[model samples]
Target chain A: MMMQRRLTTLFALALLSFVAVASSPPSSRVVADSVYAIPMLTLRDQQGQLFDFASLRGKPRLVGMFYGSCQMACPLEIEYLKHLQRVVAAGSGKSISVLLVSFDPARDDLAMLRKVAGEHHVWPPAFRLARTERGDEGMLAGVLGIAYRQLPGGGFSHNVRVSLLDAQGRIVAATDASGRPAPAFLRSVDEALKNP
Target chain B: MISRQLALIPMLMLPFAGKAADYVPIPAGQFESALAIAGHAAKLRLAAFSMRSEPVTNAEFLVFVRQHPEWQRGQVPSLLAGANYLRQWQRPLEPGESVLPDQPVTQVSWFAARAYCGSEQARLPNWYEWEYVGAADATRADARRDPVRNQDLLSAIEGTSGHLPGVIGTRPANVYGVRDLNRLLWEWTGDYAAMFPNPDARVPGSVANLALCSGSALAFADKNQYALMMRVAALSALRPADTAPRVGFRCVREPKRK
Candidate 1:
């Protein structure tokens, strides 16, 4: 019996070692379809017009998820993601947009999403504040792997992760915005795009 | 002299021993197990790993309670204890009885994940390192047919609402060669919940005022539940502790020298 448990431990250790080696950065190839972008409903833009991911299917997005009321990391994360956009445009000479999704659906209405955009000096088509529906907020929580519970007055506990998707609407990568190195990730994506 | 040359040949072979490097860069969901297929990640200098996975399960967590029992946040760690380790696990039946052994463990506290990892001669994967690991692209899942892709079922069941945990393993491994890195549950890392420099989400300003005011921050960082947003918020705090229900872990190591 002792030997058997030892074997199990050995097995687990071996598996972990093999896994550790097998896991590494992906090589340039057909970018996988990981990030799923099928929007539950058409989100409204700053002007309250329907924003369709399908319409922009061909281009990739540097998507950001945050609430308008957040005064801490969310604002900073949003700024960082936008900085990637700026850096991407400046370096690659190509246009990429950031989509800021709010965790606080109750607070972030169409008007609120737009107000935050304006306050931050974001330009046209640079970013979109996705309006939340009754249950849609939970839907997003699932899609993005971000979880938050509503606090007493109206706060939430959430993480900062920004996703990158290829033109085919698959999840390419979801970068952690907590201590995110946005430009490095973008540079890798830029490299992936350049390949082939 | 011929025999002496033969002995030298064996010495040369000894230096080139062990498993051949299997680092292949492919999209997610293509490899059989993301964890299984990923090669050694970028050298883990200064990066630490959680001793274990997320939400250490009931059966596993119960064992923890048996040892320390003080982690219940002033409540009895064993109060809800059934057959599981910690009393924290609530669904899919208890451990050794459920089908979630491979699922990302949940319901852990930083304290718990930390303790477990240390005992095993491992540590929590650092935040950036974990991100780089989870970021292993999975869009090319079918070709690899990895167990990590098993998470697809949960997402499909959730109906694109992105609310439920995806089933484990049906996709390829990321470049890190990690399996099931994404779909099991939000994992715990050594990073804290608060932003940089401070690294203490448990502190007042670490998490936003919303979670800070209600004392939910404690529960938020409970290490169980793997509550996506809360866990993400805790990324900045990085408090450390022992294991819990719904929490399990994988270990990382540097590539061995030839």
Candidate 2:
């Protein structure tokens, strides 16, 4: 009788565990379902390190796209992002990660990426300069709402837009990252960090 | 009995052989594009590539959805497609009686179209490539100079509304032997986002501010090409996840080396 009772208890515990596992959402599903989440892509950073994009899921980030050869807007974009990071850190006491991906993968090789990173003084783990191995860079651009076209003179005409993603990779704020950081966007970042 | 079974083998293999999509080679060339950069007409130097002879059909998309159920109507993530995506289909896996097999598939999002192209070992053509091929007519490779031809294209676009898309290849092929570049659905390009004239500039005084210093805005070299202008306007208005009743796509690939 005791053996049968113990068997019944074991079965109930197994069923409870199965339900728990089934009910909770998987980490991949959470990332895949978010509208602002970057797709499962493997990219190489300026340091020639291969990292899955999803690895940045657990931190709030400011993401944008630019090319290394961009003479004017790209350099300013990096400066603006750095400025925003400083402001967010100073105001909220939280450091936001920055990721600037390259749309011109063919021209922006590792050396070029490294050169730009060094010029901008962007260090990894806080700021990352990266490019994809293939043509999916356009898809990333589309999701971030950045527009770019290659010009006849081998330059690019691209809009500058920056997006802020929460720890789970959900877009909390986005704005034109052309000049000084918009105060409204900074407030959104502050709110995002405060809640967590 | 064994000889009779052997005779049926060729018949069984026929459908599979016919399932492959046909691609035509577009020769490499320096072509002038309608969209301008830095206030001048952009000249594109294209490499040799092969393009699908026709837009993807409803039947073909059905096969893709079956193999990739994640792309099916209800199954697809909202990030990849809006609520209206494939809403006209009878079911997730079936195009149904209302949707014909040969009709060019519409109501597909850009992400979905890109995935379909990827599955075929191809990718969506960039806007420049699409515009380059679109400049052709049945006779001349570059026919944008002909006002009558341009007028006909405008009429075709005006007439396509409130109507289901006709079958692909029903129209005459372009000079490059590709069909349905016009007079059909508005197709998605790989670089649709890149074609925006000045999306950021629309932010009201933002352009005059620091944002405008980036030189991101584009200008049209030939504003007289109303047809191309209208297409660019329509495509620019869409987000990657948004789907339309008339928007569809075809794939392109680099020509195979001998």
Candidate 3:
């Protein structure tokens, strides 16, 4: 009888303990979710065709920001992207995908962005241009993983970044055009391609 | 500690991260600098950084100039005249775009640039720091070249393609965790004397005055000599007296103010 009573008491303690543990939030020691759940954007090019980022999953992507009228940084950006392209192609004979998103969507209309697109020789999957709207810009901005703030003076301030989405559509790393020094971005993309 | 508290007493009157404008960093080349510019609503803060690997951008400068028009007229602090090379006060382009919103803000005097920094709650960087980042020869020189964008980029309105609309906030940033330090426009620095040929005259009146020099000593002794001549040439380029269509500026924030 005593033994039975002891067992019952032990069982009650175990149940209480389990409840106590489960009731509380997960402890810091517990393995947590990954830090980055980088998102992919859904966009349409100047042609108004559906541009789904999910389709580009599985390879490293390079994105450049500029509008048609950008005199200073845009040209340099395009120059460096092309330079990065040749260097990567020369080394691996693999062509990388480049995206040009016009922050000035109002002026960089579909036709205008397309003209720039055609000028860049962008077709199907090689290179592309995207025009965004102020209303849906958040969605586009969210996927690119950058935040933009419009200044009172009609200018904008945004976190300037190029996110390299892995094949799984996870952002592996982000780099600045000037920050990577060419070799790093080229080597990284090539490396990401091979290992992936 | 007491003085610091006194400084904060005035700040206590202001809101936290008060309505300063936001700024995005253009990425620099190579391993990114851990430094970040935090933009919480209107306030922009340069988190403590080891060094800025790139010069400031035209877009960033435009914010400063617009907030402080006095900079446009060159009524700002300077130990010497034209200490900071502010070349132009610019108007926009063409029939509709006369304000040149997309062009880099130019014609900023060093004094003006400094005032802009102060307004942003930041400071212009010392010449050593500015030169170190802007002049460093890194592994990559700007290598990307899109022929179409290049040929068509110039303001050749009334040409085949007419004009390409000016764009802001859309260029790829550099790797040093900086944006558009080069090719976009020239950056102003706090170190004018060290940068110009006339080191003696370049010294700010604040520093020179501390040493106790008279007005005669401060004047440009000669308009001759290559040094003086170069000073004038650079001055023409750097002074805020003239506003150019192409000039722009970047700003720096000094932590732990003196």
Best by TM-score: 2
Query: What DockQ would you assign to candidate 3?
Result: 0.01
Report how far off residue B157 is in candidate 2 (Å): 1.4
For model 2, how many clashes?
0
First chain of candidate 3, TM-score? 0.65
Q: Write the per-residue lDDT of candidate 2 for residues B50-78, one digit (tens) a residue.
A: 99988888888888988888788988877
Candidate 1 docks at the CAPRI level of incorrect
The C-alpha stretches of model 1 lying farther than 4 A from their native spots are: A1-34, A37-39, A53-55, A133-135, A178-183, A192-196, B1-258
Interface RMSD list for the candidates: 16.9, 3.9, 20.4
What does DockQ give for each predicted structure?
0.01, 0.42, 0.01
**Model 3 / residue B172 / CA error / Å:** 46
Residue range B188-256, candidate 3, lDDT tens digits = 544332222222221223222212223212333321222222222342333322223343345664444
Better of 1 and 2 by DockQ: 2
Per-candidate local distance difference test = 0.47, 0.80, 0.45
Sorted by DockQ (best first), the order is 2, 1, 3
Q: Candidate 2: where is the Cα deviation over 4 Å?
A: A1-23, A26-28, A31-39, B1-18, B199-218
List model 1 lDDT by residue over A1-196, tens digit each: 9999999999999999887777633421223223332223356666676654445555667665788887786777777777777677778887767777676666788878778888887755777777654224433443444445432235554566667766644556667654445556877667645642
